[model samples]
Structures are given as structure tokens and as C-alpha cells.
Target: MRYTSEDVGLLIKTTQYRHHRGLDASLAATGISLVQWSALREIERNPGASMHRLAELSFNSDQAFGTLTARLLRVGLIERFQGPGRVTHHRLTPRGTELLREGRKRVMKVLVLSFASLDEKERDMLGTLLAKLLT
Candidate 1:
């Protein structure tokens, strides 16, 4: 049967839910929410990144981004300092780095399980197709 718009919407929702769930499971013992984990990861990858930039990078709103950053700050996983344009910049602390290291290990385990069904060729094809769609 051909998929309808409803089918597509449901598929998207389901996929997103599963994605979050996997990340959540991975972060369970790491003391960070999925959003926080994502925020930290983004900041780590882009050193001296601002909250506005992080929001844009994560496709989250400014408010939502602030919430994530606040959580990380409370946990001492991130620090906010002054930067160009007087913007507040975020950087991971040593503890934050350690947490990220632990969190990534867990995330990788979850990812391996999630993609276990896909063989190497299929995985490559999926990655290529996803890149095309993203661009």
C-alpha cells in the first residue's frame, strides 16, 4: 500500500521518538538529558560557540537553547564567558569533557545497536542518501 501524508508524519514522529529514547537511555546514568547531551556535544565540537549559535546549530529556539545551557552550567559541565559582540560564549569544563567522554561512549553503544541491522554497504548508502537530503 502507498503511504499517505499521515503515514509520513507518523513515521517522522516515530523515528524522532526512537532517536530521543535511544539517546535518553544512553544518557541515563550520565546525569544529562538528551537535549543537554546534544547541547554539550555541539559546544564541544565548536569551541567558543555562543548560545545563539548553539541554538541555530541544534535547530532549537533561543529559549530552549538557554534552558539546555543553564542545565549544563548548573552541572558545571559548561562555562559562560565574555566574547566578541559582548556575546556570552560557552566552553566545556574538564568535568564536562569527562562527562562528554562517558556520554559519547554510551551513545556509541546505542548507535551500534540501532544500526546493527544495516550492513556496511547499506549503511554507506543510507549515509550518502541522508547527506544528499540534508544538503
Candidate 2:
């Protein structure tokens, strides 16, 4: 079997999907989907950011994020405020904060297992290479 850059790209995408699945399953005990937790994380990291900004940072479309925000708001996991020019901004509620903290622990465990095949040095190299590629 021959390996090419296209194969490498496909493998990268596949690995990411599997990693997301692992994280999602691990986080199920916390009662939040991966997407929801991701949204909460972005809101926590960028407090007072507009929904559009949050959606962009969370990698969702504006309309999809609008629906997500509505769900979050309804559940009291996040609160929205009117920013400048009537733009809606988001922040995590106490519940959201706790969930985020718990979710991070679960995610870390999944991430460690996901890369269990790699030694520390290989993991470091992979991280560096991926960062370089991303940048």
C-alpha cells in the first residue's frame, strides 16, 4: 500500500472525528453534547462576544448558532446581554461554568487515550507540526 498526502489528510480528518466521538461519549455523563460544551467554552473564553463571533469561534453557522444559543439560554446554562448597537452577547452561567470544568477533565482523559499510541516526544512533535500546519 502506498501513502500519499491525500491519504494523510483523510487520516487526519478521520482521527479528528473519532476524537470528537470519544469526547462526546465521555461528556455524556455531564449531560451536554460536544457541540453544546464547545459553545459554552467559547462563550466562557470570550465573554461578552456577539453570537456571530461565538458561532465563528465555535465553528458553526450564524443561524445554527442562533438556535444553539436559544437552547443554552432556555436551559440557564448561558445568559445573553445586549451589547453595543443591540448586538447580543453571551456569558456562561454558574451551571455552565461548572459543566465546563467537569467537561474539561473528561475531555483531557479522552485526549490522552486518543494519543496513547504516541510517546511524549512524538506527541510533542505532532502537536508542533499540527500547529505549524494550522498557522
Candidate 3:
């Protein structure tokens, strides 16, 4: 079996698409999109994370972050509060935390099943390679 440039491109695109699709489907029951889910997860892990920080962490453009924040705000999942010197900070509501915890379990189950074919070493290598791609 040979891997071509097109194959690599497809691999990357499809992997991302499928991951997002799976998460979106699982999160649908929780009334969140994949991006919203991502935002919640990051905020949970990094309490008081700012919109700019979330944008950077998610690799989203300013417009994208703004859009997502609007949606998240509309859903009552997060709230913006004044931080030091009046800077804005994002905090997860109780509902957001519970949703994230439950959605994370579902997402993890999907990911574990998806990666079941890969050996532990392959999974580690994939993680390292993907990190390199990001960097």
C-alpha cells in the first residue's frame, strides 16, 4: 500500500471531519456543537480563560471566535465577567460543566472505538506526529 500526497491530504481532512462529526453528533443531545464543546472543555481545563486565549487554543480566527462566543453566550453555557483591569474572562456555568463531563465521556468512547485498530505505539506516534503538524 502506498501513501500519496492526495492520500495524506484526504487523511488529514477526513480525520478532522470525522472527529468533528462524531463529536457534533454526540454533543447534539447536549445541545452543543463541536466548537462549543471544545470551548467548554478548554475553559474547564483552564478556568477563567479569555476569548483571545480560547481563539488561540482552538486556532480560530478572530471572527470565528467571536461567532462561537456569541453562540455560546446565547445558549447560556458560559458567561463573560470583568477580570483584572476590566479584562473579560470566560467562565463555565454549572450546566456547562455537567454537559462537558458527560459529553467528554461520549466523545472518548467514540475516539477509543475509532482508534481501537491502532496499537499503543501507533497511537503515541500519531499523537506526536499530529503535534508536530500543529507546530
Instruction: Using TM-score, give the best candidate's number.
Output: 2
The true-versus-predicted C-alpha distance at residue 88 of model 3, in Å, is: 0.4
Better by TM-score, candidate 3 or 2: 2
- lDDT string for model 3 (20-126, tens) is 88878988987777788888888777777767888878768768988987877888888888889977888888888888898889899889988999999999999
Error of 2 at 61 (Å): 0.9
The deviation in Å at residue 49 for candidate 2 is: 2.1
- Ranked by lDDT, top first: 2, 1, 3
> How far off is residue 19 in model 2, in Å?
0.8
Name the weakest run of 10 consecutive residues (lDDT summed) in model 1.
Answer: 8-17
Question: Between 1 and 2, whose lDDT is larger?
Answer: 2
- Candidate 1's error at 7, in angstroms? 4.8
Residue range 38-115, candidate 2, lDDT tens digits: 999999898777778889999999999999989999999998788888777888899999999999999999998889
Worst window of 10 by summed lDDT in candidate 2: 44-53
The TM-scores of all predictions, comma-separated, are: 0.87, 0.93, 0.86
Candidate 3: C-alpha lDDT: 0.84
> Residue pairs in steric clash, candidate 1?
none
The segments of candidate 3 whose C-alpha lies over 4 angstroms from its true place after superposition are none
